[model samples]
Target chain A: QQQVKQSPQSLIVQKGGISIINCAYENTAFDYFPWYQQFPGKGPALLIAIRPDVSEKKEGRFTISFNKSAKQFSLHIMDSQPGDSATYFCAAGLTGANNLFFGTGTRLTVIP
Target chain B: EPEVTQTPSHQVTQMGQEVILRCVPISNHLYFYWYRQILGQKVEFLVSFYNNEISEKSEIFDDQFSVERPDGSNFTLKIRSTKLEDSAMYFCASSVRLATNEKLFFGSGTQLSVL
Candidate 1:
């Protein structure tokens, strides 16, 4: 069973535009939501994360908007750049658990 | 920043042969994890280890798979018999704490190809 589902397998955005990716999770036990950025031939790196306590969290140009009632979260990249083009994955996990359920991933391309 | 290290960035093995993927997690990290990503697929958790034992594992981890921390600094995953479907990119990750919220440092990966 897929615990987390993501949409828009691929995305393209012009530089300086906004890029958005969305994900939904089925497990309510999940309290930690994180977004990971992966480059070709590299492992996924932690980009930004948020707890269910907040409706939104922002780190520079990266923002995570979470809706607990909807069991959904989305990542928004403002002023997207070519360097930001990479595979983005949304993951969910429990507070004390050691495993994370990851989304299928969205490959973003920021064209100049 | 400290990072997890995996050896033999790429490995090719014949089917039914045994293969062991090695990893050296961050020195100060107490939690270790193994995750795999099949081509064009989502990353899946295989197992988690802490205090020298497996804390949790997913259904994909069957009897064919095993994990070990033979030395204080090294963690390894062994597949007794490689299957064609085992071809994937294996990642090793480590964290300072067990909380899922904690940041996990990941190694680039070991691309295993089973023929």
Candidate 2:
């Protein structure tokens, strides 16, 4: 129930296009979900996050859509730019949880 | 904006040698954690520390592994005897506190190479 599975091991989109990555979790207890972006030689940084209470959350060009009943979530990057190319990870944790369950990760590439 | 930082960005040690990975979490953060990534694999959780005590740990964290808050400014992961399979990138993370409202901040990570 702690596993999070991410799909589309890799994705490539043209500039100004939409890039999507999907993740699903089996743990209904998870209340906190986050997406992390990582670059070569750098630590994974928090990109955006959402609580199960909301269906979606947007930060600029990044949007996270959550489906509680479906036990799934997705990340959409609008107007995908080359700068957006990197490894993205989806994670989940519950209240009082000591560890965050992570997905396999997706590599997104935006061709300019 | 505060982030966790790790030391000795890269370390190469011989098999069976002792290894210690160090980290300096955000000053005010109350929870600290250790994670590792084997090349081409997903990151794996090792342990979590809170109130200067271990709150939880994964099965991967065996007797050979131990964590210490040693002093106020640092947290450390000690491996009594390393093996070739132990080679990987070690990441240290911290959080405001271990709750639903807080997110973990990660370090750049230290690459451990066991030869």
Instruction: Give the per-residue lDDT of model 2 (tens digit) for A1-112.
Output: 3488888889999999999999999988999999999988888888999999899999999999999999999999999999999999998888887988888789899999
The chain B TM-scores of all candidates, as shown, are: 0.98, 0.96
Kindly report which residue stretches of model 2 are placed more than 4 angstroms away from their true locations once superposed. Answer: none
List, residue by residue over B6-75, the lDDT tens digit for candidate 2. Answer: 9989999999999999999999999999989888677788999999899999998999899999999899
**Candidate 2 colliding pairs:** none
Fraction of native contacts (fnat) of each candidate: 0.84, 0.60
Q: For candidate 1, what is the TM-score?
A: 0.98
The DockQ figures for the candidates are: 0.81, 0.68
Residue A15 local lDDT, model 1? 100
lDDT tens digits, residues B1-115, model 1? 7778998899999999999999999999999999999998899999999999999999999999999999899999999999999999999999999747598888999999999
Every model's TM-score: 0.98, 0.95
Q: How many clashing pairs in candidate 2?
A: 0
Evaluate residue A73 in candidate 2 and report its C-alpha lDDT on the 0 to 100 scale.
Answer: 97
